[model samples]
Target: MDTILGVSKLSSKFQVTIPKDVREILKVSPGDRIVFIHEEGKIIIKKA
Candidate 1:
């Protein structure tokens, strides 16, 4: 369950691709909703 993916590139639209390990860790799939919140200077990412 451990893997790493490097950033390929960023498109002109400001969209960045999520690494495979991160995606799996977050249990994110296509069309899945994710929420980002800021707490105590840290970013919290959660699945919605």
Candidate 2:
């Protein structure tokens, strides 16, 4: 599988928009739940 990298800015409301490339690669859609894991000083996001 190809790796995709994208950058997004966090909003004042503490919301961030997932980049299009990532969304497509992860096959995530609107209303889908995502999980964030904090490890080794980094955050990992996965489809839930």
Candidate 3:
């Protein structure tokens, strides 16, 4: 598996942009949906 690294910054509207490397590793393209899960105080992003 490939590891992508990038810092996350929150916009004024509270929206975040996923790092390009991470998106590519996950093979995510435009219009694809993702799921955000919270467990034990950790957030996980997964393809939907």
Listed per model in order, the count of residue pairs whose N, CA or C atoms clash below 3 Å is 0, 0, 0
Clashing pairs in 3: none
Comparison by lDDT, 1 against 3, better one: 3
lDDT of each: 0.78, 0.89, 0.86
Off by over 4 Å in 1: 1-10
Instruction: Give the worst 10-residue stretch by lDDT in candidate 2.
Output: 1-10
Model 2 TM: 0.82
Instruction: List the candidates' TM-scores in order.
Output: 0.65, 0.82, 0.77
Best by lDDT: 2
- Model 1, 26: alpha-carbon shift in Å? 1.1
lDDT of 2 by residue, 1-48 (tens): 835587788899999999988898789999999999999997888999
What would the TM-score be for candidate 1 when compared with the true structure? 0.65
Q: Model 1: per-residue lDDT, tens digit, 1-48? A: 833455547889977777787788899999999898999997666888
**Candidate 3, residues 1-48: lDDT per residue as tens digits?**
845488889999998888998898778988999999998897888989
